[model samples]
Target: MKLAIIGAGMIVKDYLTMVSDIPEIKLNAIVGVEQDVPTMQELSEKYGIKKVFTNYEECLKQADIDTVYVALPNFLHYAYAKKALESGKNVICEKPFTLKLSEMRELKKLALDKNLILVEAITNQYLTNYKELKESLKKIGDIKLIECNYSQYSHRYDAFKEGKILPVFDPKKGGGALMDINIYNIHFIVGILGKPKSVKYMANIERGIDTSGMLILDYGNTKVVCIGSKDTSAKIQTTIQGNAGSVIVNGPTNVLSDFDINLNNGFSKHVDDKINDHRMYEEFKKFNELVADHDMDFVKKELDHSESVMEIVDMALRDADIQLG
Candidate 1:
């Protein structure tokens, strides 16, 4: 697939580090706002990209491009993905597909009506290790409790404290602990367990944004707690407790690195499936398959799952009394 990148942010560097090794995909161009032309051109040159443009319309007019990777800020995802789909290009949008469920629903309908592929670029759901974790769930028997925590202080927090509200901390830009960091924990849980019967959130608010929050998901028989924080740090781990045994996943929820299984009366097993590459690797591989096979079914399923995630997030925000601009 010939891919045009819509943003040149910190994550784009990680994507470039891996895309160079994949033979099936090509970096066709990098596009950004007019003020970011110099940076985009530099990235294009460094990554051997063929073209660079400051206008979205000009970039979308490139007929050779088969897909567009919308890596812009959270708030821009819906608009950019909609335009890309309208332009007949498959879109691989970044996480928290949109701030609201209505926006995601609209994008999903547009992609389907256009017969195009649209996927949320969430790493955990695409990783092989996560699939294995799902397979091991049955071994643990009836699940009763789940605890997931993904917390790391954001680099932009300092600037936020200084009254410079960056995207990571700005409500107007879909910024908050829930949308930025907590979403990973939600994906790891929801992808495996499906949607819960009820959802609620308790968040620490600062300037109308959630800096840290605890999400409680009730599945009737099972209870799950997801902890996400950008104002503090924690030993990131995911634990699935069941009647017969339990499973423990180490490393961040976004990066499924290592895991362990302990049975009630048997020896425990340690699993180490650490991949050195950045989290973007698995997502790109999945996108390639969706584009090559022209699989609308797979695309729709992913979109539906993303929509559910956003629905839960929206409800959680309401429960916590947080409002985004």
Candidate 2:
């Protein structure tokens, strides 16, 4: 698949780092503002990309491109992705697909109507370690509780405190702990347990945004809690408890790494499937496969999962009384 990238931010470097190794997908062009032209040109020369444009629409007009990866800020995801789909190109958008569930539903409808692929570029769902964690859950028997925590002090928080409200802390940019960090926790939980029967959120609010928050999902007999924070750091881990055994996953939930499982009987096992490349590798590989095959069923399944995750995020934000600016 020939692909065009729409952003030249820090995260775009990570995506490009991985895409360089994947031969099936070609980096056709890059689009950014006038000020970013030099950096884009440097990147284009280094990566051997064919074109660079300051206007995204010009990049979209390229007949050689078959897909577009939207890596812009949170608020721009919906607009850029919708335009890409309408322009007859598959879209692979970054996480927190949209600030609201309503926006996601509209994008889903558009993708279906246009017969194009639209996928959220979330890592955990595509990682081999997460798949192993799911398989290990079977040995744990009936699940009683699941706990996932993803928290790290953001570099942007310093600027935020100085009254420089960048996109990460600005409500208008869909900035908050829930959207930036907690969304991954939601993805990890919902991908495993599906949607909960009821949901509630308790957050630490600062300047109209959630700095840290805890979300509770009640699945009748089973209960799950997801903790996400950007103002503080924690020993990030994911634990799944059940009747017969328990599974402990270490390292960031977004990266595939080593984990251990302990059974009630006395047997213990450790599993690791760490890859050398950045976490973005798995996602691009899967996107290439789906787009190449024109697999709408697989795309719909992923979209359904993404939609459920966004629904939970919307509820959590509403309960916290946090509005996207």
Candidate 3:
């Protein structure tokens, strides 16, 4: 996976830190705006990245890379991913794949047509613990209810309150608790249950964006409620209940770092099968291997799951009458 990162933001820095651990993911180049050249250069030098480009087209045309990682602001996901697909490179986009379901479908179609791997860089889907959690569900009988909460009062929330709107809280930048944080819960649910029968969102709106929200997903016999917030904090946890037992996640949905399963028969066990401490490592390692193998079957399955998640997000936003870029 010869990769060219498309942003110089915090995620890029975080990614650079552990990239060397996966020798398959060669950091070929990084592309950013002219204003970010210095930061990009510094990162390239520190991380041993081979090239830095201030122009996207030049990076796409000249960089010795086969994949692009879209780590830009939320609103830029669709356009940048579309461009990478058009440029004949595989893309690993950050979560909330796109603001709209239509955009997701378009990207999926283009990737299929071009025989390129287009995947969302979501963490839980590839985590070992998350996978084990899914398998452990069979021991718990039929699932009845699921509740996931991933709320952390953002440092930017204070500024947002004072009318200093940054991209995170800005409506036009696809910023909100739902898109920014809750999407992980959506992915966690949708990945396990496929799609919901109905979707609804009740949000705490401030200045046109959701500062916090409760999303209800109806799955016939199962009921799921996902809570996400940028204005409050809580112990991040997820619970999946069944008539015979239950599974409890001890950490954020994004990491699924620890969990326990308890049965009605008094049987219980804790599980943590994670390969790496960093949440992104397992996902990227899998991404690199999949891209290396050109495993479109697995990629397509993930794309289907991603599409379901996007559909739920679109429905939730529409139900709340929240418009975002």
Best by lDDT: 3
Candidate 3's displacement at residue 49, Å, is: 0.5
Q: Is candidate 1 or 3 superior in TM-score?
A: 3
Encode model 2's per-residue lDDT on 216-305: one tens digit a residue.
999987899989899999999888899999999887778847789999999899998756457888878889999889999999999999
Candidate 3 accuracy as TM-score:
0.98
Put down candidate 1 lDDT per residue, 282-308, tens digits, no spaces: 778878988999988888888878988
Question: Total clashes, candidate 2?
Answer: 2
Worst ten in a row by lDDT for model 1: 271-280
TM-score of every candidate: 0.97, 0.97, 0.98
lDDT of 3 by residue, 166-255 (tens): 999999999999999999999999889989899999999999999999999999999999999999999999999999999999978998
**Residue 229 lDDT in candidate 2:** 90
| Superposed model 2: Cα runs more than 4 Å off | none
Note the Cα lDDT for every prediction shown: 0.88, 0.89, 0.94
Q: Using TM-score as the measure, what is the rank order of every candidate, best first? A: 3, 2, 1
Clashing pairs in 1: none
Regions more than 4 Å wrong, model 3: none
